[model samples]
Target: MWKMELKLTDKLAIERTRLANERTFLAYFRSAIVFLSSGFAIIKLEMLREVIWIGYALIVIGPILFFIGLFRMLYVKKRIKKSYQNDPD
Candidate 1:
């Protein structure tokens, strides 16, 4: 009975970790979208002509954010897999 309880607890913890990981990825994705949209707006709007560098910077940052987020998600996934494997329960 104790072993069964431990297993159930471990399973729940793992599920929670996975959900948290997904939430983090979604947050990153949202940030990337915001960066991309802001970049587009700056580049397209005539008022931003005096400071076009900001727009280009945002455009460059958008993809960087996306890739960084991707890398973090994969890294967390691998870590989680390792944790699960190491768990005796």
Candidate 2:
């Protein structure tokens, strides 16, 4: 009798895809950070400081993008599960 068996489950089969997804998420996070920093800089700028709405809008947009990336990950996870569960025929 064999002590162990080697198999490729659906989740394991798509590991690279999952990793790519993670990399994409990190990229979005980087963009979000850049936007946040830009917003703070704008707030500190003498001439631009008066534009309170622009600063506030940028700050709000950064977090919204981050949350969108987070939700995309969740959506992809569900898609992966469904793909793995489907029958080939």
All candidates' lDDT scores? 0.87, 0.77
Which 10 residues in a row give candidate 1 its minimum summed lDDT? Answer: 1-10
Tell me, by TM-score, which candidate is best: 1
Q: For residues 13-35, what per-residue lDDT tens digits would candidate 2 score against the true structure?
A: 67877888888889889888988
RMSD of 2: 6.4
| Segments of candidate 1 deviating more than 4 angstroms | 1-6, 86-89
- Maximum-lDDT candidate: 1
Per-residue alpha-carbon lDDT of candidate 1 for residues 3-61, written as tens digits (9 for 90 to 100) = 22347777899989988998999899999999999999999999889988899999999
For each of the candidates, the C-alpha root-mean-square deviation to the true structure, in angstroms, is 3.9, 6.4
